[model samples]
Target: MDTNQIVRAVKTPVTLVLLAVLVYFAANWGLDAVRKPIPPRPPEPCVVQQIGPELTPDHVYVRVYNGSKTNGLAKRLGSVLSADGFKVVKRVNADRDDYPRSLVVGHSEDSPEVALVRKALTNVDFMADGRIDRTVDVIIGSEQPGAAEQPDLKVPLPDGTACLPKIQTVEVNE
Candidate 1:
């Protein structure tokens, strides 16, 4: 047999094998890309509070009430509480829509969860109810501090505590 004929015969099979390999890889790559699952989207970041507590947030079932007219204030506060580990069961509007100050009211004075809820929110008042349920009611008032569209209450200082220096009248030569 001629050498050129042998070479030509060998090249056909070799080229066919290479083409097969290339086609195999291309099909696999395309199928893998289509079959591969897309990574799930990450959840929204929670603003968890750093208040260490004897009890976890799940221990307290909080019911948030928007005592003020501020839209979504109770919901926002509820989200903060939920992020902090508190068990926020409900968010609703108060029966009376007029509230001057926010309050954290427990089911009873002996209720143990009020303190934990209050600890998350330092600048609010608290109350005790006579009901026999395990729930904490957070009434968000118009003056609720640390919320948007309103400022926190200013702290009262003792006399001479102002940063400005006192001025005294001085006699000057004309």
Candidate 2:
């Protein structure tokens, strides 16, 4: 208590107005605890299943979308349907873009993930839209559904179980 009486009791004026009201209530409670806002977790349930006998493209699960006007056409076709191993999970923007071709909505356009994403498009078209999980929605239009061939890499599954999707591994930094 002797650094000149603690700098004369912190330069008094009621201790400098209690240190400016404790630094303005700790800078508004530390900016309301750093501008509060964190609620966002609840999206893990992208279907699931796969007993397999054959159905490659990592058991298909796409979602692409980008109905034309091509601006990052559904994230470049969801990275070319995730490098053709499918399981994209979701890319978006399709409520109408004057789509002149591509499409693949599923649930049964000869399900096998909509004929393996309409055989990786080139002028695709197909739509059943029953949607019972077994995801598959391609969409991208105005012509640009190129890359994704596989000409039959595997598609047996006559019911060895296959309601895929649940492989969520996204990390696209670019």
Relative to the true structure, candidate 2 reaches a TM of 0.37
Report lDDT (CA) for all predictions: 0.67, 0.76
Clashes of each: 2, 0
TM-score, one value per model: 0.51, 0.37
Query: Can you list the residue pairs that collide in candidate 2?
Result: none
Score residue 67 of candidate 2 by CA lDDT: 87
Off by over 4 Å in 1: 1-53, 145-174
lDDT of 2 at 174: 100
Model 2 regions more than 4 Å off: 1-10, 14-18, 32-39, 42-50, 56-59, 70-115, 123-142, 146-163, 167-174
lDDT per residue (tens digit) for residues 1-174 in model 2:
669987777677787799899999999999999889988874344454656777787777778889888588898778877877887877989988998988788787777777777776667877796766667888878876676455665668876777765655679999
